[model samples]
Each structure stands twice: as C-alpha cells, then as structure tokens.
Target chain A: MTATDTAARMLDRGVTPERYARGWHCAGLADAFRDGKPHAIETFGAKLVVFQAANGEFGVLDGYCRHMGGDLTQGEVKGDELACPFHDWRWGTDGRCKQIPYARRVPLRARTQRYETVVRNGQLLFWHDPEGSPADHDLLPPELPGVGTDEYTEWFWETVPIKGSHCRELIDNVVDMAHFYYVHFAFPTSFRNVFEGTRATQFMESKGRPDKAADAGGYGDADMVLTSEATYYGPAYMINWLEVDYKGFVTEVVLINCHLPTGPDSFTLQYGITVKKPEGLDDKTAQYIAKKYAEMFGTGFLQDVHIWQNKAPVQNPLLCEEDGPVYQLRRWYEQFYVDVADIAPDMVARFEFEVDTTKANEFWHEEVAENLRRRDAASEADAPLEGAGH
Target chain B: MASFVPTSEETLADQRLYTAGWLTSVSCQDCLAVVGVQKNSAHHTSIQWSAEALAACPEMGRRPRELHAGCPRLQASIEQAVRAGQVPIGAGDGF
Candidate 1:
C-alpha cells in the first residue's frame, strides 16, 4: 500500500503509536536511581537505562550496548562509566565509547543513544524526541516547599497499568469540566482553562459531598470549596495542585502523574503524592497529617482507573458548551502528534482563554506563568534562524 | 613598541595585512559579503553566522536550477570553503 493508504489503515485500526512532544518524561522518583547502579525504564517502546554518575548526575541511554547488543543495566559501573556485561566495552556518560578491551583503538563513531535527563521536584525526568532533536526548553517541576527535606515527608507513589488505553484520553480529562459533576460527583462553582503551545492549565473550583472528598482527604460532611489547578509540561506529564477549604481548616496536596505508553494500546500511569506540613503544628502531628493526605489523594486518583480502562477511543467527541473546552484541549494536544514543522502555525491558532485566578493561589497561576516566560525565552534563543539567503 | 631598523640598504618593506589567529574573519569572494566571523582563545572559541548570508549566496541552488538560477562557479567556491574547515553558506535549511 502507499504511504497515505498505510497511514489511514493504521489510524482506522488504532494501532499507531501516538507521537509524543519533545520534553521530559518522568523516569521515576529522583531517589530511586541509586549511585553506581543502572535502572531499566520503558517509554515509547524504547528500553532506556537510567544511571547515576559518580558525580551525582543522572543520565538515560539506550538500554542495549552498542557493541553486540548486550544489556547495559546488567553491566558493571566504575565511577562515571559503564562496562558492557558481554564484552566489557566501557561507555561514558555522554554515550561515547571510552575503552574497548583487546582492541588497539576505539572506533570514533562507537556510541549509543543518550537521552537528556533532569531532576526537578524530587522526580527524575527523561527527555525524548523521535528525530533526535535536542531539548529546546526545560521542564520546571512545581516549586513545592519541604520537598526532599527532613522537615517534610517523602513522596508516596503508585503505578496503575491500564490495558488498551492511550495517554490522549487521560489528557482529555483535563478539559472535561462537566464530568466533575456527573462522573466524579464534583459540584463545579467556577472553571476555566488556558492553553499555550506545549503548556496548558486547568483551574477548577468546586463543591463535592464527603463521599467524593473522602478519597481526597476532604471532610465529606462539611461543604468545602475545593480549588484545583493542573499544569501540563507535555502530553505525558502533568502536575496538579489541589486545595481544600472548609470550616476554617485548609489542606493542600500536589499530585504528579506521568503516563508512559508501553505499547500501541497500553500504558502505565505513575502517580505520586506529596503534602505540605502546616505551620505551628508539631512534628508528629504534621507528619501524621501529611501521611493521611497522601493516602487520601492516592485513593481518589485510583477511582478513575476503572473508567479509563474500559473507555473507547473517541477521536472527535460531540462536545457541548458545558463540556468545557474539550475541543480546544484536543487542538493543543494535536500539535504534539503532528509534524514538528506544523507546531509554529498550530501554536498561532491555539485557543486563548481568560483564566480566573481569584479563588486560586499564586501556586496555581503565578508560578506557571513565570515558568512559561523562562521557557519561551529559552526556546527563542535556541530556535533555528529562518530567512531567505538574500 | 620598539622596532629594529633595517640593517641592509637593499631591504624591501613588505606590505601585507596580518590578522591575529584568534580573530579570523571570512567573507564570500563572489559577492564580497561577510560570511563568518569568530573569536577564539586558548581555551574557548565562539562563532556566529547569519542565515541570510547563506540564502543570499549567489550560487545556493542546484545546478541548472528550475526554481532559481545560480552561478556554478560560486557553488564550487562554497564546496571548497566547506572542505577547508570554514563555514559554508547554504540558502535554506530545506525545511
């Protein structure tokens, strides 16, 4: 079949691997990758080996060694280099061949794929690009206090492996505002969303009964105004901040969700939760509250896995006014799957919405805006020059 | 600065321009337009070029071009520059 015909067939059969944007994907918790050991990770059908150098810097490279296709994770690490298990061909942090035993000289082109990585907000993020494009902009994790410190508790993580699912559907949940009331039982008071290029924000204020709030560590009996703001770094990574205000007591929690596709119709959802300790609370009480909140948040997020598991892929949803900006969100998401050359025009025609930040704290809006500013500046600096020769 | 006087009466004064090794500048010989300029030191080097410089090159297109005509001689010069480890200009990135 011709290329166009093959593409159509793949789309019709829903067998194509969804294209991902060039940004960071959560490898795992930052502390999970211990020094002198390599961790195996799978994303976008690529087996990646995540390792920490002796200098404390982390790197992600192709899991298989360039020589003889040996697994790098099973190899031995000495200082900042890795020796292949089969042949002991040592590779450096940059994925370049360092030493080849029994050979007079190492080939100049002997190297494997090395992905860019960064640690932010206690999470280890790996960068991916199909065309081998370098990272143009950085992913800035939420600036949360008491993270990775003795005063605050460590993050609690859970993994939910879903069958026959794609990440785009989960992304659709960000703009499905009406579902709050019908599906999740959240009473919406105010809702708005803003999309710009690779970033998106959803601000929601709602009132839900204790049954719904119970999972999120909310007092189900008391009526509370729960303000939630979620930000997307790319198609696969999202950070959500939720605040519960009721009866003069407030509880805040941050949820980091990373959706990684293992196959065409399968993905693993990595969910992490962390809470802040209130001021003037004793160490024992603060720890208890943080732990309790983590438990509740984890329970609440798991409630959606059942629905996501059974839902069919909807390419074009019959959207309504109250259904929130699902269409707009879809458009923003389309840029990631399309050719990178089309990103310029797509971003120009992106939907612009006026976000209501009155009920939201600075954490929801101000920080996101600032991060976008820095990201845009960096992108401009790195953009290839465009012009006619003359 | 002090310089020694010519000791021989038959000595001839040479008139040639000399630039430092760290501040070399390259220009297109055909159009006589500045192409690439760089600053270098013992430990670091920084080079900068303009996309328009490549696009404006007299012979940037294919030979006997269909879209736009270009001079074959100038195209050969660009190839030579590339071989000489100098920045060669090309019209568009073919995006």
Candidate 2:
C-alpha cells in the first residue's frame, strides 16, 4: 500500500486529532498539582507533561524532549524549566530551550508545543484545538451554593477509568433519557430538553427511593421523587443539580461530571459532588453528608458505565417512538467530531431547543444569598468596637 | 596596586567568570527549592537569584508566580551581560 494510504488506515484505527473538538479538556483536580513536580497525563491523543515551577507557574509541555526524543516525565524540574534526563537540556515553561548543560549554543528551533491552561473552581483545564486556534468561548464553572465558602462542604471526588469507549459515548448517555427507567431502574414521570448551539440542558423528574439516604442536611431515609436539572457546558463538562424530595422536604446536591479522554478508546470519568450543609451543622457532620452523597451518585452512575463498556459504537440505530431525542442529540454532537462543512443545514437547525429550569435557578440563587449573609454576619461579629477603640 | 588591563591579566574583571562555585547548585533558603541557572556558559561562575512560583508562593507568600517568572531583575542582568558582549556564544558544554 502507498504511504499516504497507510497513514489513513492508522488514523482510522483510533480517533485522530481531527475528531477532537475545540474546547477545554480537564487536566486534573487542583490538588493534584505539586510545586516543582512534573505530572504526565495522556489526553487528546498525546502524552503531556505538566509541571509547576518553583515560582508557582504551571506549564504543559509535550512529553518528549526535542533533543534525542527523551521522555520528559523522567526529567527533573529545575526552577521554572524541565531538565531532560537524557542530556540535562533545560526547557522553560514556554517550551523554549533555556539551557543545555553541555552545549553553549542553543538551537533556534529547540522548542516544543505548549498547550494553553486555565484553572477554574479548583480544577486545571487545558484548551485543545486541532487547528491550534484560541478558545472562542469561555466555559464557566457552574455557581453552586457553598462553592468557595464554608457554608457548603468541599467536593468529594471519585474517578473511574473506562475502556472500550470514547468520551463522546459517555456524553451521549446524558441525552438518552429512556435509560433511566430500563438501566437505572428509575421511572421518569416527565422529561424536558433544551439545546442552544453549544449548550444543552435537561430537566427530568424520576420516581425512586435512595438505597441508604442520610437523615441530616434535609435528606431522608425514605422513598423520594428526584428532580434533576443538568446543564452541559460542552461535550466534556456538565453540572447536574439534583434535588431529592421526600414529601415536603427537599435537599439540593450538585454533581460536576468531567470526563478526560485518555486515548481514542479510553477515558477517565471524574465525579465530584458537593452538598449544601444545614444551618448549625458541625464540619464533621457536613463532610459526612457530602461523602455519602458522592458515593450514592457513584453507585447510580456506574450502572450506565457497565453498559457503556460492553456496547459497540452504534452509528445508526432503529429509533422507537418512545426513545427520547437520540437522533436530534446525535445531530448536535456531530458538530464536535466533524467539520462544519460536512454537517447538513437541517442537522444544524436541530441545535435550537429550550427547556425551563427556573425552579432550579431559584433554589441555587437562594442558597448563595444565604451563604453570603452568613459570611457577612460572621465578619460583623469578628469586628471590634471601632468607634470606642479610636 | 592598579587595575590590570585584559592584555596583561588574560581575564577581564567585568566579564562573567565561570568559577568553581558555578558547579554547585544553590536552593532557596526559605523553600529549599533549587534555583535554575547555566553553570559554565558565563564568565561569573555563580549568581544569586530568587523566584516565586505562584500567587501564594508556599515559600515566601509575597509575590505572584507570573511576576517571579518574568522578574525584571533577572531580565535586566541578562540584558546587561549580553549587550556588553561578555556572555559566551561559541559552542561549549553548558554548565
């Protein structure tokens, strides 16, 4: 076979760079970064080495060094530069050859590709675009109650590595509403979906009982109706606001689901959850509730993971009357994988759908206001007698 | 005693001299982090430096990481050394 044809066959073996969307992909949680240490992670069909300089500058460089193709992960971090183990060639955070221990002259072309990085909500994200263009839109981390404040417990994170499926396959599961009744064993009473260009929102009410729900934090150990409002920033990140109602009482929990594609056929599913703490609750109690809620969500999400691992890629499937907007969702997802020129006008038009999540917004906004009020009150209490002291 | 000229002394005092001290790696006294530098490329063997890696530097907690990376003090030293034609340019095993 010709060399060009062979390269084409190789691209088809797994997801090539062209299939990668222009968006921010999760690098890892903020706590994972250590100063003066290099972290090597595989994502977007490349091996990336991330490191924090002695000055606290974060840099993402191509894992291989320019000289002798040395593996940078084995290299030592020197100040803000990474020193390659093979030759002690020091690379600056900008991927430029800052120093060569044995050579006085540095090559002009001695540099590697550096990915753009941004830290948000305690998570590090790197922008990936096939064409090397800057990110067009900003992906904001959802504003949830207790985030960055003591009023809410910190997010308890759980990671599960999946094989034999692409990240898009996992994203597709979000819009597959029918799976709740069959796979998760929850009966959905109503479902609403909204798709506007890059973002999609799904609001659903499911009738189910928590296997072992906590009594504190307004949660109960009884049968409850679960209402969920999920907002997708893109195909990679989602913020799901879940409200568990036990008769008159309701507790809100926000689940931030971020999927990082490790390879063409593999990805890591990171699930982080934070629960709104009840007033007058101790730190220990709040932390316990957060952990329990995280585990509960982990248990439920794994059901979908089990099915996803075994299922093959279905390009086209016979649609039933009851199946939720799977085809329309697929049309929206096409823009991520394929170029704009390849997509039809009719498919592009399907991206304009809307769902009302007014109640969910009210619930979150109220919690934020309460947290701010409590913070203000605490600050006032700490203030000394300003007029008398002067 | 008199200031010796380059033709008589063989090494200029103003030039960066690569001394034996350049081989020794120095770290921040506070954070105990190693400072990055070229050991043998210049006339002066050893140089003193400081850096902060983040906004809240775990070591000093005073400067932003970005400011530390692009510190004018370090840049000014390099620029002065280069303009004076004192920094070595020929191929040699870098220190």
Candidate 3:
C-alpha cells in the first residue's frame, strides 16, 4: 500500500495482462461418438465434455463445469440435460443449469457452464480462450478430409502429456520430415520435402496461424514437405495437422494437439488420430484400420509419452540440422507469450487440401511391399478361418 | 464346442477374433483371445504386443520393463475398485 506501489498496482489492474487467447486446441474429432462414445481424456489441464446434439453433431466442451468448479463429463446426460453428479443439477447445451429436480423452484443464481463447440473436419472443437465466444472468433480449423463426417473409424490415442509451452520446437518435431530417417529412424536416409511447388529448406516462422507464415518472403525460404500444418496463438494451445497416408484407401486425418504456457517449462500434448474407412466396407475392415493405426502411431506415441514426462519443456541446445527450422521458429512462439498481445489475425484464412490419394506403390517399390507382404503372411500362418464361429 | 479361426501371416487379420462365443467378457476374453489368436503360431506373444500389425506381424520390439511392470498395489486397488462396481472417479470410495 505505499504510494509508488499503489501506482504500479493501479497500472497493472484491468490491463488484461497479455493472457492467452483461447480458441481451438484439439482438432475437431472428439465428440459424441457413435456406438462407442467419447471417453474421458485424463489430463489435468482440460476437462473433455462430449455432447451429441439431436442431429448427431457432437460438441466436445473443454470440461470446465461452470458451476462450482464441477466437471461437465461427470454429469449424467439426460435427454437434454447433463445432471451434475454433485448436486443432481441439470444443464442443457446452452450452458444453463436449467432444472434442479430436487429443488422447489429454479434458483435465481443457477447457471450451468457451457462452451461453444464447432466440428470442422472430424475433431470436435471448443474455443478454449475462457473469454471469447466461438461466434466472436473463427471457430474453424485448417481443413482436412473426413473431418465433417462421423462415419469414419478412429484409433485410440495414447494420452502422453508433456509439461511446457508447446511452441515451435514441438511443431517442428512433426514438420521436419527428415527426422524420420535418423531421429525416429524409420527410413535409412532423409527424403526431399516439398512446399508450395518448391523444395522447402528451413521452417518459415511458426508464429502466426500455422498456415500463415510470418517470414513468408524471407531472404531464403526453408524446404519442408509437410504431411500436416500447425498453428498457435498467445498461450492458448498449439495444433499440428498430419494427414495419414493410407495409400488412398480412405480418408485419414492425424493431429498433434497440446496446451501452452505450461508454467515456463512444462506442457502436455494429447495426440488423436482419425481414419475413414472405404465405402461399403464391413465392420471387419473398419476394425482393421483402427488396429493398424494403433500399431503404426501407438508405438511412437508411447515412446514420446515416456520421454517427455521425464524431459524438460524447453531445449538444452544440442540440436542437429535435421531439427526443423526451429532457430527462428522458437523465437516466434516466445513472441506470442512475451512480446505480442492484443494482436489479432490479419485476415481470415481458409485451409482446405485434398487428402493424398496416391496408393502405396512405386516409391514404396516392390521389395519393400514384398517384404511387408511376406511378414504379414508368416504372422497369419494359423489365423482363424472366416465364419468359423465367433 | 467354441470355434477358433486359423489365420496365417499372409492374410493376417487386425482383429484377433475371440470365438469363445458367450465367453467374451473381461474374465475369459483375454486368456481365450490369446490362445485362439496364437493357435500354435510362432508369434504367440506378437498378438499380445502389436496386435495391430497386418500382412505379416513382426517380432515385438524391445519394451521398457516398467511399461508392463504392473504394480501389485495398483493392481489390488484396481481390482478392488472393479469389484466395488463403477464409482465416480473422484469419489472417495476407499480407492
């Protein structure tokens, strides 16, 4: 309460303090699932609330029970109301605790929390900023295939959360295609990365919308072939879109999503993968696709979960050339936190791309395909015969 | 007699059909699925680890011991909880 202190406090008050601009965190996928509904994602930061509207369109809320810090998912879903287990209070999608069955009359102070949800592509989206409405801001994500449909089957994502601000470093981890050979060691050597009809070099700035580049016309552009796109703002969250190369079988979308400003050095990422099956495919084929993804992405995901849980949110500087265009990219992420606030996007950008339909051939070649085929045959030497009775 | 399907590596299936008929619940499902899916195959454990692989399932990779190292205390707690039926996650039902 000193005069100088009072003056500084007054200056800080009502200043908005350059906080995170909440919006789409997870891609639009987690929603009221058919047959198998969306289960809870067990991370501390977000409360996943999945609501299937009358039209089968789902709204996945951010899990902040607006009433008394309660969780929305814990509520018993009625025809219209999800009754809060704590108080038997009912809340409709409008976010109002509409009824208290046990109460004599609807209380004047009763209000159930609600979030603005939009499903773009397949990921169910909830604007997470805690301040803005989905109507006020753009609620759509960069487009991907099969995002708007509920027919596709999805693989269960292993919840591996890292503690830290998800910034340029994490996004680059997916953008840098060269790492598959060495870091992940998938291929023996690195391959060419193409962006905008030219071979990309380093990553352009990752500060703006992932599709929008800050150093678009930089002195020399970076070369990268992205199977996906990433975007981040303030300390809200970061999202990376990776298109699953399903060999043209069906529409497949993959995304890496995480929260930001995880207290200087710790952040968590929840990775969800979705795949669309072929038309007229039986339930068996759908199950096959899900199982395949669980292997392909699940192994790597488990590794990330273990390593990141034990690792730092920030880097220790032992970076390699294969590391994405991270030198400038990290600076962009830090800027969103420290330097820039109150700045909005220049203009609305629409992201739409055709899913890569190239079948696994030619580049995959004969030898590799043959090897996989043989391996598969050997493993199924004694598998069950069809209709042998389940 | 419960039916079991015989699969080969070439036409490997992603879903290992548990043809135990009525024995598909948790109690018998895991054990039966393991036996039925393997069916004298070389990669019996492969189904346990990477059951998602198609065409030819590969040998299971080296895994961290801790990942599969289930704790007795945790196991006991989970079993007790299951036996106590589904309780709310935050409920202090001696879990």
Which candidate tops lDDT? Answer: 1
Residues A1-390, candidate 3: write the lDDT tens digits. Answer: 333322532121111123433444553345335323323543224446666644455545546555566666666666665665677776666666678788888767665444566655555555554444344243344465554356666545544445533333354453343333223323212222111100111212211111111212111111212244444432334344444333233334454354433332344455555556657878577667666555545554544445445643333222222333232232223333232243222111111111111221233334444744675687777443222111
* Segments in model 2 whose C-alpha atoms lie over 4 Å from true places: A1-18, A140-146, A209-222, A246-249, A340-390, B1-95
Runs with alpha carbons beyond 4 Å of true place in candidate 3: A1-21, A27-49, A53-72, A102-109, A133-139, A146-158, A161-169, A175-179, A187-268, A272-290, A315-323, A334-341, A344-390, B1-95
lDDT of every model, 2 decimals: 0.60, 0.59, 0.37
Indicate the residue-level lDDT of A293 in model 3: 53
| Per-residue alpha-carbon lDDT of candidate 1 for residues A134-158, written as tens digits (9 for 90 to 100) | 7655445556676677655568777
List per-model TM-scores for chain B. 0.28, 0.29, 0.22
Clashes of 1: 5
RMSD of 1: 23.3
* Poorest lDDT segment (10 consecutive residues) of candidate 1 chain A: A5-14
For residues A149-220, what per-residue lDDT tens digits would candidate 2 score against the true structure? 776778788878888887767777666655664565455555666554556667777664132232111221
lDDT of 2 at A376: 64
